[model samples]
Target: MIKIADITNIEERKAIENIIRNYREDSGTVISLLQDIQGHYNYLPAYILQLLSRELKIPLSKIYSVATFYAQFSFNEKGKHIITVCDGTACHVKGGPLLYDYLINQLGIHGGETTPDKIFSIEIVRCLGCCAISPVMIVDDELYGNLNMQKISKILSKIRKEEMIQEGSK
Candidate 1:
């Protein structure tokens, strides 16, 4: 286990310390602590998890057992934008796989992976709960349904153009 002193980033150390202090060793608060960590950092970082294991006297395996049980938590760092493709029975019947293939080809990253540039990542989900809008794709919070490759391309292009403009300004 890496010691607290081994963490090089001053801010990260402080954040972990704050988490430990806030949660203490309360057994029931483990999930809450993990949630707090994920909420603050966007994901459970490996170093932070290790520190948590030692301080809480919980085996790393136990911690992982709990974390993996929930889909809400992610171990990998995510991109700025999350693209969710629905592959549920309804969506699948309506060409969801075709949409997914287009996304992997266009974004150059498989589902559950971020693009090399960290601008986009794809997440494949069983359903988004709106069966009426079958074959759905969601970009961040915006929902698009009844999509074809053409519409998907236009949407992706618009987002890329917006990003390029933002990058130029910076």
Candidate 2:
């Protein structure tokens, strides 16, 4: 329901124009252009995609296909904090499922869901490339290994407190 004019400011429109101009009808540059757009906005806003389609003279469906095909691209807005739980073979063997379940219970959101307040989002990834520290979960860039329910509780509490303090400061 968001309009292009509502979601895009003058500065963002100029940036998008620059990105399209730089690549200009080079279909090979589609991925790179989308990446740049995603960098500007946390996710690919529908309006931006529509604008990109018109600017590049590419089919909107084609652009959408590319966006949806990639796991790295997100269509919906992400939360302020992203929490990823490793569900790879090594992590699962090391009780990754248990950790995931614990998080779901604590946050009241399953993997791939964001909290109602938009404070946190959880994802279950195959691996975080740190199997050495199996059963690992990451909050934003910080990693926690050898996790248990107790550890998860403490981590969530700490993050909540930090969010509260940040809100108070604002």
lDDT values, one for every candidate: 0.87, 0.83
Cα miss at 132, model 2 (Å)? Answer: 3.0
lDDT for model 1: 0.87
- Number of clashes in model 2? 0
C-alpha positional error of residue 130 in candidate 1 after TM-score superposition, expressed in Å: 0.9
Best by lDDT: 1
Off by over 4 Å in 2: 1-28
* Residue runs of model 1 more than 4 Å from their true location after superposition: 25-28, 158-170
lDDT (10s digit) by residue, model 2, range 1-170: 33345644788767776777777746446788789887877689887888778767789999888888898899887777899989899999998887888889888998888899888899888888988878899998899998888989998999899999999999
Model 2: pairs clashing at backbone N, Cα or C within 3 Å: none
Candidate 2 lands at a TM-score of: 0.76
lDDT value, residue 39 of candidate 2: 81
Q: Please report, as a residue range, the 10-residue window in candidate 1 with the lowest summed lDDT.
A: 21-30
